[model samples]
Target chain A: MLKDITLGQYYRADSVIHRLDPRTKIVGTLVYMISLFLFNNLICYVFAAVFLTFVVGLSKIPPKFMFRGMRSVLFLLVFTVIYNIFLSTGTVIVKFWVFTITYEGIQQAVCMLIRLFLLIVGSSLMTLTTTPNQLTDGLESLFKPLKIFKVPVHEMAMMMSIALRFIPILMEETDRIMKAQIARGADLENRNIFIRVKSLIPILVPLFVSAFRRAGDLALAMEARCYHGGEGRTRMKAMSFSAGDIVAWVILAGYIFAVVFLGVTFKTFPEFLVLEMKAGLEYLIPTLSAR
Target chain B: MDIEVRNLTYEYDSGTPQAVRAVDDVSLTIPGGQFVGIVGHTGSGKSTLVQLIDGLLKPTAGSVYLDGEDIASRKFDRKHMRSLIGIVFQYPEYQLFETTILKDVCFGPLNMGLKQEEAVNAATDALLRLGIPRESFGASPFEISGGQKRRVAIAGVLAMNPKILILDEPTAGLDPGGREEVLGLLKSLNESGLTIILVSHSMEDVAKYVDRILVMNEGKIFMDGNGKEVFSHVEQLEEIGLAAPEVAYLMKAVHDAGIPVATNITTAEEACGEILRALKN
Candidate 1:
């Protein structure tokens, strides 16, 4: 059951999406996400959906494998759908004793639902195609300006990569420890919520101890290898952008422009999209989008 | 209790590209109150086989009858299987979390719903049976030597009074003296009527101690026999990245040198007796 978690999982395949530079993929994902919120009509959604599906096909990752991650976010998806269903206001399409369903409310719900789904899937595409090391390298390079302010960017990036490397190792360790406790008759399953939490103390206490021990051993191993806070470290595999990445960026820029253009021309764009864009941008930047 | 495995098969991460048949169509039996040892090279399914017997893993397509109860069946009581068959995994001491050795040892029996005093008595009895001193009972398990901590971990499982005990490389990290101490403890316990399943890579230890041996290779039972009989087929054993016991090799060397000694002697004492008898003749 622990193996079912697909967080930060990368699927390795030979495809245009996987072969593109990590920076290009990261930037392209950002542009694609921004384009998702710049639309409010069925035509714009159709264009977005087609673009996404095309990219998914190009990536060569199985659709079933890609969407398997949505299981974890099902709760959030349902919550947002319900929230938009009753709260969004407009012409009342149906009226019950205490509840009213509006045409605009249904439209808003569909838009919000599409946006949320696209947002998760779009970002997951980046992680699925790129390795954690490549992702870290891209992020560190993007955040290189922070080094000018002496923010220790290199050390932070190194720590993150090491943490990612050990996640599977720690997960396997937890599985073993849980099995050991179970052989001792520790009931991790079949308990009430309160008792279950209490029962986890046996599992958690040892897990914490072993984790600390592993951390200590890792620190010692690093010191033995003369690791000194990422100073003067050079990557063996250097990062460089190629022509394929340029083509990808060009397509993304065109896609963003088309979404913005079609979004504005859709009837009801003035009333519905203005409010949605405002809400979306406010989420991106609290201060800048307050207006 | 007896364990009867019939056509047992297990696969890790089945249906994916990474799927592995760690144990395949393997059938065997561990009769009650027997000292049995399983020998295999790395990835030979030795570890996976033991876990399957105790219900830690369910077989994909087979049955495990633990004393006439189908342990793989849906109605089988999993918790009862756990208590019936205790497993001390490799480096078992790493799971120790209690402050004192006594509490750590009592953890298993307490988990089985024994009263506090009864659990304490059972734990103390287990520690005594393993020859752990009373003075060390109150000490922290972390404060002891690596060997002592391993014994404490084993004692924790023994406190449950399991009908069958399966240990996976119980002496893996210990020194030679500690290894003998641990093995000696296991030998005496086996003699005193606790069914023991010893899993190890050390052919020397298994040859010297266990009366019955099961050799595994690539997820299948390659050979099974008495220690003397299994160790006699040195070449076949070596073909699969395993070797006969050191004594058998020693006797073989003497025989090749025309000393006319039997090369099938697996234990040191048996080799010594055969060598002495040959010299007298």
Candidate 2:
């Protein structure tokens, strides 16, 4: 049951997005995320959503698969939405109990949820399309200039790739240990909060020990093969910018341009759509409350 | 405590593009008190099959019946049934986490809702039966040798008082002596009427112990019979990347060398007796 983690996992496919240079995908994710925070209005999100949908379609990964990845961050999404709705001060739309629901608060909540959703899914898309090795190669290339300042870019990239590789392995180990304990009558599904928390001790302790043992074995194996840092290492599959990468960059630039243009041209949505939405909500809320 | 698997199938990562049919449609019935060994190449679904039987995994397209009741049915007490079937996973020694060996062994009985005193007694009995010395029970599990730690892990499951014990590669990383110790212990456990389903990659190990053998290939039970029946088809077993026990090959060599001995000898001891008789003749 623990195998549902999709974040940081690459989905193999022969698609335009998957074929793009990892550097292009990484930079595109960063720029796209920055664009989400660049504008405060819903019109920008319309463009953002269209772009994400187009990229998601081009990536060839199943929409269901992408949404499944969102399950891990669902709690954070709900928490942030609730936090914005109750905490922000504005013209109060409804006041009940100790809580005040403001028009501006609801607006902020919607915007925040959309922003967080787009940000997470956008970044996750990048990882989903790119292998961990490709990601490390991209990071190493991007950080190559940092080496001029005495930074260990290669070492950091190597460590990151190793860590990413271990994630699935460790998850598999955790699942095995959990089943073993369960077979021995470990009651992981106890309703009591304290007992449930305490039940994790069996899983966590064994997972940690096995992880450390694996790490030690890996280190020894690497040393035996004379893996003495990335200084003199040569790449077997060197990263190169293909024609698809250029097309990706151009699409990203166009997306940024469109978002900025919309943000400048319309502070919020166009007047008519907003009025129509408000009218629609005015007619919708009361019948629901009457029921 | 008999297991009846009816058209059982399992898929890993179901509903995903990467879904793999780990266990295809399989039907087998293992009676109570049977010593069965499941042999397959790696990824042939031996482990998955055992887990499905243990109810650790829900089958995608079939049902497992424990004592004539569908284990996956809602009304069935699956948790209680699970407690009756102990599964010692591969590298079970990694499951030990308690401060002391005795406490670790006590985890199983305690989780089964046994009283503290009763749990301690069961744990002590299991440990002693597994050949763990008394003084070592108070020591940290980490301080024990690898084989002892594995035995303690097995003892932990034994403490739960399971009627059926399913072990997946229980002797995987042990020395030859340790492997013999574990297999011998399992043999005696089977003698005591506990159904033991041993999943192993070693043909020699399975042939030496289990009364019945199931040869799995590509998620299907390719062969099912006693050792003599299964090992007799040495050519077919080799086609699926498996083999008869090494002694069977030795016997085959002996038979091919003009001796009138049978080539179906599975164990070294049996091969010895047959060879001595043939030489005397």
Candidate 3:
């Protein structure tokens, strides 16, 4: 069951997005995420959705596979939506039992949910299409200017690549350790949360120990092969911008310009939908009170 | 307890494009007190089949029956399965976590809801049976040798007093002497009427110990028989990138060289006796 995690996992596909430079995808994701928070109107969100769908389509990743990453953030999504719906102050549309639902509150919650959803999907697309090694190479090349300020950009990128590589290894180890503990009759599925957490001690201690051991062995192997940091290191697949990357950047720029332009021109939800929601609530609340 | 798997199929990453049938429509009945060895090349679904039987993985189709009761049925007590069938995964020694060897072994029985004294007694008995000394009981599991750590891990499962034990590559990464010791221990355990299923690639080990051998290839049971019967199809085994024991190959060469010895010898002792009888004739 632990294998269901799709976060930070690369999906292999022969597609335009998969072959694009990792730097382009990474930068495009950042631009898309920033644009998501820059706009709150329904029109901009629709535009962003169109953009996200187009990119995801080009990536050739199955919609189901892409959405599986949403499961991890589902709890946060629900909490944020619920929190926004209750707390945002605005014109009240329905008041029932101490809970007030406002038009503005509904609008804000919808916008936030869309923002979070788009943000997760846009970023996940980057990770899903780009391999870890390519990502590190792209990042190191992108941050090459930081070397002038004495920053260990290459080392940091190497560490990130290693950490990313270890995610699946550690997950498999945790799974094995969990099964071993369960085979020994460890009650990991206890209903009590505290007991469940306590039972995790058996799984965690070994996971951490093995992770450390693996890290040590990896370090020794790297050293044995004369890996003395990323200095003087040459990449087999050098990071170079391609025509597809340029096209990706151009599309990202257009998306950002559209989101910003629309966000500036329209500061709130469209007026007619708000009027219709008020009318609907006005007709519904009195009938409920009459009952 | 005898285990029966009926049309058991498991798919990893099910419902996705990358879904693969790890165990495909396998049906097998393992009677109680049988020493069965499952031999296959890597990625042939041996591990997946064992995990499915252990209930670690829910089959995409079919059911597993323990002593004629469907273990996956809602009314079946899953805890009873956990306490009855023990699984020792490959590199089991890496699962050790407790501060002391005794406490680590005690983790199982205590989890089974045994009282403190009873758990300790079970743990001590298991450790002693695994040939761990009394003085080492209080030592940290990390302080032990690799083989000792493996024994402690096995003791951890044995303390649960499981009737059936499944080991996946129990002798992997061990020296020849340690491999023999572990396999010998398993043989003795099997002789004591505890059902054992060993998953190993070593044909020699399988021929030396197990009564029944199941050869898996690409998620299917390619061959199922006793060692001699399975090894007799040496060409078929080789076609699957597997082989019979080295002695079986040697005996085949001897028979081809016009010796009157049998070509189906699967173990060293059998090969030696067959060769001697041929020479005597």
Q: Supply DockQ values for each candidate.
A: 0.77, 0.80, 0.82
Write model 3 residue lDDT over A176-264, tens digit each, in one string: 99988888888888899999999999999999999999999999999899998867778787778888878878877787788889878
lDDT digits (tens) for residues A1-291 of candidate 1:
588776588887899999999989888888888787666777887889889999999999888888878899887778666656665567888888878888766777787778888888889989999999999899898888898899999888888998898888889888888889889998888658887887787777778878888899999999999988756788898999889988988898798778888877775656776656554453346423443
**Which pairs clash in model 2?**
none
For B72-180, candidate 1 gives per-residue lDDT tens digits of: 6789888777788999999898889899999999999988889999999999999987779999899998889878888899999999998899999998989999899
Q: List where candidate 1 sits over 4 angstroms from the true fold.
A: A264-268, A278-291
Worst 10 residues of 2 chain B by lDDT: B77-86
**What i-RMS does each candidate reach, in Å?**
1.0, 1.0, 0.8
The CA lDDT of each predicted structure is: 0.87, 0.89, 0.89
Give the interface-residue alpha carbon RMSD of model 1: 1.0
TM-score of chain B of 2: 0.98
* Superior candidate under DockQ, 1 versus 3: 3
lDDT of 3 by residue, B112-211 (tens): 8999999999999999998999999999999889999999999899889999999999999999998998999999999999999999999999999999
TM-score of 3: 0.92
Best model number under TM-score: 1
Query: Against the true structure, what is each candidate's TM-score?
Result: 0.93, 0.90, 0.92
